[model samples]
Target chain A: MSDSTKVRYLEGHKGPTVEIPTPEGVPLRFTVASGGDRAGAFLLDAFLIIMAVIVCGIVITALMVIDSATASSLAFVLIFGFRNFYFSGLEILWRGRTVGKRMIGLQVIDRSGKPLRVEAIFARNLTREIEVFLPLTILLAGDELIPNLPPWGRLISLLWVMGFIFFPLFNKQRLRVGDLVAGTMVVQAPRRTLLPDLVEEPAEEVASGEMARFAFTREQLDSYGIYELQVLEKILREPKTPAETLLAVSERIAKKIGYTGEMYPSLEFLSEFYRAQRAYLEGRMLMGDKRADKSVAPQAGKPRALQTKLSGKERSRAKPSASAEPLQWRTPEDPPQAASQAGDPAGPRVPPVPVVPPAPPTPPADEV
Target chain B: MSEIALKSTQFRQEREKRWRELERLVTQVEKRGIRSLTADELHDLPVLYRGVISSLSVARSISLDRNVLEYLEGLAVRSYFVVYSPRRRPGEVVIEYLTHSFPQAVRDLKVWVALSMAVTVVGFLAAYGMTLSNLDNYDLFVSPDYSAGRNPSSTREELRAVLMNEGEKVESQSLGVFATFLFTHNAQIGLLCYALGAVPLLLVGLLLIQNGLILGAFAALHEQKGLSVELWSWLLPHGVTELLAVMLCGGAGFAVGMAAIFPGRRTRLESMVVAGRRAGVIAIGCVGMFFIAALIEGFFRQLVNDLTIRYSVALITGLFWIYYFGWVGRKARPA
Candidate 1:
């Protein structure tokens, strides 16, 4: 297979199981998996950049106030010492990313897809200083102090400069000394999909055909029920899986569920299944599983307006009686009763508490 | 058989195509976003994005290193002063002041050369003209002390002997100083002449004329003396080198003066500046000759005092230097 084909295969199999091929060798399109928002990262980057510029300005002004020779020497030391620091501090501290990768919305992650190891971060930063910055800076500084020293000083300085400037020529990661020592890689930040709450409408572009290419068929996609699919779809969009191979398992389960058609289960479905399947595997299926039915009930028949709030006029209340049943059903008017039942011990473990903010009212087109 | 062969060829082609695609894909992923490519794309990423990937790849090479920045800086400063004539900025008051003072140096050199020649000429004229007019007055003009010391002879012969021996007793001790002075003075004059470009041409022309007259008078005086050979012998050993040095200096000064007054296409200051650099070369050459003159004066002239022998030696030395300088100067194209 061609290289692009290999890339396409990974895109197809990974995460939320987006089929993602556009068509016939065109731009490879995949359903977007759930990813993290970068507003925080952007703010951090801006802060770091401001700090570096101000510090550099202060140094430059101070150096200028001294003799020309001394000023030049200072410039040499600072340039060599701090070029890598700027990139490293900004990458690891403020934005939690490197400028090069950040500009493109990428983040560096470990093999396990966790935040970078501090040691690796510092090592990489140090290496950049060692290979390019330090040697060249020393040469730059040395010549100014002892100009009459033999050509040896000059020759070494030249070699150092050449090595650094041409560093990009031979690096696979476009990394100089720092990158080599650190053993880190730059990768794009995965994009996020905004999922509305139960009463709200779905986002306009769900990238339907992309998720269908995974192992599951269309019936399994719909059969999984809209709420599971909706939650699963939202989960698929998360940038990192935290755990690997979730998509493959989801596809296998989706295939076993009597789903036979073109549309496959999305990352959204897999993540929800991953959570709910844990309960099922641990023998926590409710009698008839009617509670799961209730959570997904209001989403049926009208997927478009799922973003909207359910009206208060229709309401119901169900008392939680201590009964061990495989499943129980709740009417559309009794969402709170289902919610209370879901909180029970035998039920799928609810998240400790909802950390995500409640869905806001749909704003005017311009406001959002 | 043909079908089998065709199938195998197709398979080979497919494999090769895959490999190339893979390389390109890797390269692309490295430079741009890896997410920009699909999983299928990444397998061939190295091949497709070779440039990008290789750029990221760190390779090592060995070679000689040079500090180009410092080298350029040194060249700029040294060459600016040594090879090029210094110039004040256009409309700078300094240029005007330099121009006014520029001729003084050249004029001073011219005056010294003229004064020496004047003494020689007046001595000769006094001897020659007085004898022609009246024998008795010849003693008063040439000086009774002059021939009193010479072997009894004609007024011209007596004057020639006096001129030949003039400064002879002090010659050995003063030879070094004289030679050095000649070398330094001539070199300095050449520099001044070249540098005077900041001033008017008239001053340089006057300097050249004055030096030329001095030389003429000095030579005519030798002819007036009956012992012309003796006089030539005494002076020629080093005089030729010394004269050449003076003339070259005068030429440089004249060049500068003319450049200042009659700058064509270039501003007066600019032309004078250009001439100054070229003139420096000539001035340096003049200094080298002065050193040769000093050598001759200190050792050669002092060692040989026989009237006939000294004349021949002086004549040969004079002719040799004159011919050499003229030939070399002709060949050298001044900037």
Candidate 2:
């Protein structure tokens, strides 16, 4: 697939990642390093190399006063070695990282996810001599290399070199000629530590039984699935989320789920809802009944069979009891049958079954 | 709800120690080389890597905590590179390259090498015939700066003197500097030939042919003065190695160019990568050849004036190279 489409697809699901399947069938996802970071790393490495060459020149000049012959030969070999082998040698020894890459928190990795090899490293760095250093030298010594070169010739040469320099900008992966030829890519190497679980945080108000202030029926809870739960969890976890945004989101979710109870202090209501939804989803997951999203029809054999059996027995019993008593609060400890019985007294409860006969559309419940 | 809470939290509690240990070792290896780790730590590295990888898989499936999942992924990637990167020592790598990789690479490109040799020879013959027919064509083939003092207008004695180490003082100290300079200069030219191979075939061919034209024109200039024998002695000792080095580079360039143009069954990029890799090995070996040539040109040719010794040295070098590239590494499978 073209990179643009790939990026759009990834953005729809998650971030851009390089997925490498391991022998154990588990695919590992690594975030691709940004082009800006790669360019910064390259500039840093180039600066280091130039500084090294300059220091070597100064030392050799000092040695020239002692023995001109030895100093000249040493200068040639040292400068040549520094120019040619600095990146390759360090990468070989350090395992796919040079000094700049380490500092910038980037690394070269095989595109196919194989172990980086010596020949691959050599191929990549050798291309640098052509892709970067050669063009640079040509630009710097254009008159010396080609005597009496015209301005137009220089401009063409400049454009040619610039094409090579900006090559990575044209690709989604930000791969230069070296990376393409070597079948490698640079990636971010972030160091991270696990943070405390968001779920484990004490819900003191909910624990004190104030969660009963917002009661959701089985159908309302079933309206969303794990994907929506995760999105809600993200919003809840982000410290930067605005209070107004939380209130608006809670209002929208309340409307969708048909919850008419008071939701003053929307954060607490959302948090309590997050907990109940998570518990519901995890409970289903334990029974091998994973609900990927709201669109997925409930699983075929087990849950459907149970729901059909319950709907046959409870359909008559639920309608008669619905309008007979005032709405009752259901605690976290209440069973599903008990919670369903405590549904709103003003309207008939929606049966907790996959298949339901058509009924008159219920009006938007009055704000209680 | 209770089961999930217990499962995720307790699962982390059970494995967090090992994960942290692995992270510590990985961080150590990243800061220093693998040698910084103790032997026990070394044994544990791969085992812990596998553990973290498995943890990442499990966490991805069950954990809703994005921080935990992200942390495991980052840790797994870092440890993966450290554990799997090639660890062969420098000495072993050098020995392997010299004994197998270099010669095998050269042999693989033999067809292109022959083609490169033919192009240079055609240029040589054309230039030789032209210079012989008319001495005025020498200036066209050979540039003024490159000709130094020896040209068509120079007398026979002056041309002969250019061939011999006469009428010029040779400082022993400067020879070292001269050899170093020639080595770097020739190596750069070889690398340029290989680099240009990626651009177009015509460019590489032109460079090779231009080198041949200069040599052919100079040979004709000496031939007209009846100093062919002296010129041959002066040039052959170093020329055999130097010319072969240039041809190897040209051949490598040809391989790259052909890979780009034809590509056979593979895509153009894929073909170029394969060719570029093999060509890189040849390009590296050519630098050594240029070094040898530079030594001979700067020292041995200047020190040894006897015609017999120079011819013998040149013949021996030719035979050695023929045997080295053709037969030395053929008996062993490439590494």
Question: DockQ scores for all the models shown?
Answer: 0.01, 0.26
For candidate 1, lDDT tens digit of each residue in A164-224?
A: 5566446433433333333444433433321222211111122222221223212222233
The true-versus-predicted C-alpha distance at residue A257 of model 2, in Å, is 10
Summarize candidate 2's per-residue lDDT along B1-335 as a digit string, tens digits. 11224244455777889999999998898787778988778877877777788787766545545567778999888787777654556788788888888889999999999988988898888888899889899999997888997889999999777678886878888899989988888887887788778766898899999988988898888899888999999999999999899999899989988988899999887887788778878888898999999999989987888999999999999999999898877776644
- Give the whole-model CA lDDT for all candidates, comma-separated: 0.40, 0.74
Superposed model 2: Cα runs more than 4 Å off = A1-16, A201-368, B1-10, B28-43, B333-335
TM-score of chain B of each: 0.46, 0.92
**Local error of candidate 2 at A214, Å?**
10
Output the worst ten-in-a-row residue range by lDDT, candidate 1 chain B. Answer: B57-66
Candidate No. with top lDDT: 2
Q: What is the lDDT of residue B136 in candidate 2?
A: 92
Per candidate, the number of residue pairs that clash is 85, 0
Q: Per-residue CA lDDT of candidate 1, range B177-295, in tens?
A: 44455444454444444333223345445555545444443444445454556666767777777765666555655555565566799875456444543343344455566667767
- The CA lDDT at A81 in model 2 is 76
Model 2: CAPRI class = acceptable
